[model samples]
Target: MTMTKKHLDSARRTLELEILALQEQLGQLDHQFDQACDLLLGLTGRVIVTGMGKSGHIGNKIAATLASTGTPAFFMHPGEASHGDLGMVTRQDAVLALSNSGETQEVTSLLPLLKRLGIPIISITGAPYSTLAREATLHLNASISREACPLNLAPTSSTTATLALGDALAIALLEARGFGPDDFALSHPGGSLGRRLLLRVADIMHQDQQVPRVLPQASLREALLEITRTGLGFTCVTNEQNQLLGVFTDGDLRRVLDLSLDLHQTRVDQVMTPEGKRVYPEQLAAEAVHVMEENKISALPVVNQQQQLVGALNMHDLLKAGVI
Candidate 1:
């Protein structure tokens, strides 16, 4: 069948209804929302999320959002909870249950056991006076005016409202706990943000024997040999005291060669870049990448507070370490 104006109009109406429902729910948040957040923030154990069907699917996403944003949480299917999964929760933990009607049998069936265990319950329900809401320690109203579905039978607007509320709770808790990007990176170690934040210069830089170094008095030819030996395409020009004086790279050599300078007699100091860009061992490799990018250079020497060269690194090193 050809897509027509009726279908288009119906789709637009559905989204408009959902948006209006979320706006209404946003207006409904009051002290109850704050109370739920306070309870979750005070928990010593993880937040246990439970629901049935669509709510369960939404709960899974909510739990993942919570976990990534500094809140320890996991979704436990309510049906599984009544069988034996209830053991996963303890008195120290808090439960956040979802049921638009606030009367889902599979979810409400765990009320007595949760009460016996003394675990605090925060219910997200459309029905304020339902059994689940009345029994909860804190009730968050996810009540929506109507479903986005034309039949008014599916959980379209209600689920969207619940998801938005879940996001609001997670972000509020994240800010209250002073959760920052570095802390978030810890929870996402395998992600690019973690690699950028956690990887340091010392972890990827070449140390000691791997560094190409030459005394300032060394001839350009000698520095060239050192660069070739280390395969770093550059050599650090240092004084007798081993303090970095300058850097001589292939680019410098090219410039010198164009000028017809005698490589065998020209001293390294004559062509070296004076006391150039440097990094520290404790600094993030990502910072090294920034420096390299800003200057359009491929290599850098790692130095200490005293300006002593401790290590060296290049673009290849960053790429190999997955920091680039």
Candidate 2:
């Protein structure tokens, strides 16, 4: 199909106008924005965001973002509030009202009750001089000079500005609450992120009797037996103190096979790699994964700082932990 220059020009024009409008709306990040953040952060109960029409949709998304990022928040539709949904907001909570014209009757009607209850009200509107903004303890000016639409009817640029303001509010709350990646993982614990943050080396490592192990003086055949029994590809050789001495792996077995050595007569010390790389028990399973990958090894013997053999973890454990 042949592309026309007229259609491309129209698309580019719309994008440029919206971008400029959004940048113009950045002036809303003033003291009023600070006051709104403070009000929401100081709330004893969840933040209650209320709005009408398209503003309501943006309010819902903002509420969800705040809720997931460690701030407690929820959206309350103004149209529903007129029909008794106002019960969602309480004296302990703070209300963030959104109305482009500041005259959304359904939203404005709740201000009197909110005021009487001493519930702080913050407003997001295009008109800072509007009734809703004037009545609010904090007013965020999400005003745009013109709509991207030619007839000045449709809400294209205005809605985008409102949504960006919502993002700013959510991120401010997230930062002020000290919400970090691990906190985020806690909220989203069923996915890959949860596995990475929550799963530890101890959680996935081979324990006690399951760990492949043999004494330093044990025959290579004995080490092979331990590896075969545990099926973990490696055997740890420890001293009388249960301290790590060396390690013999499947790779060592292949090398010994190349030499045609007598497995029963060959001592493990002769075939083993002494003082092999090891990890601590409390180390992050992800870090263990990095060590294994960097060295091209499949397993690592976990030991204490004093070098006692405590645990063994393999690539399979990391794979299960989603760190691989």
Candidate 3:
């Protein structure tokens, strides 16, 4: 069945209400937020995030963000904690407890153990006077004026407020820990941004015999043979001293054929692109990718400080390395 206009309009209205509610809830961030960050930043062990239901889902994501950003945190279900996961929380650890009404039976059940361990507790709650907040070492008021549901019961605005507060706490702790992109990338090594930031050009480029190159005085046939044998789709034309002189590629050969030139009689220097794009060996493979895209080229020759050919990389190399 197709969706009706009423369905889309209802969803949009809910989202709009949630956005405004979140904006209103943001005003609740105050001195308690700063003090809570101080407690988390001083932690030597992990941050134990515990919540119930929807709050548990948001807490899981918050814990991931906190861990990735260098805060060293993990989410432990309070219900599970009561059943023996409490062993995961050391005295050095800090706890982040979430409950919209400031009193979830599963979460409140852990307060005694948390107090016994002497672990600091940061409570994210709407009711500052509730049991959870009253027992917390640092109480962050995430109180929202109302839920986005017209009936004012479903967790819409309250969840948004909780999520925003969680993000603020994670980011604050990240800044306090002096976290940088490299630190962040270390934890997200499988992502593209991590690969781009952590991987070196030498890690992906064709190093020795795989590099396609030919002497400038070589015949067009010789260069074409090197390009085909290496499967780089291009060959670097270098002087006898191995200094790059030009580059010969399928595109250059296309232009050369248009001249109706004699391949057997032609030196690669005569038909190669004299001003073809080049990259330094020390440059990042990501930068080379950018250069290739900008110039609309498929391959680039890696040069040394002395402008001597050192390596050869192609778009295919990047593709094989999962970089492009």
Clash totals in order: 0, 0, 0
For candidate 3, give the lDDT of residue 142.
Answer: 80
Candidate 1 clashes: the total is: 0
* Residue 55 CA displacement from its true place in model 3, Å: 1.2
Of the candidates numbered 1 and 2, which has the greater TM-score value? 1
For model 2, how does the per-residue alpha-carbon lDDT over 251-287 read when each residue is reduced to its tens digit?
A: 9999999999999999999989999989887877877
TM-score of candidate 1 to 2 decimals: 0.85
Measured over all alpha carbons after superposition, the RMSD of each candidate to the real structure, in angstroms, is 3.1, 3.5, 2.8
Compute each candidate's TM-score over C-alphas.
0.85, 0.81, 0.87
Using lDDT as the measure, name the better of candidate 2 and candidate 3. 2
In candidate 3, position 78 carries an lDDT of: 83
lDDT of each: 0.93, 0.87, 0.86
Q: Please report how far candidate 3 places residue 110 from its true position, in Å.
A: 2.6
lDDT, candidate 2, at 237:
95
Question: Clashes in model 2: which pairs?
Answer: none
Highest lDDT scorer: 1
RMSD of 3: 2.8
Candidate 2 structure lDDT = 0.87
**What tens digits encode model 1's per-residue C-alpha lDDT throughout 29-138?**
98989988888888899999999999999999999999999999999999999888988998899999999999999999999999988999999999999999999999
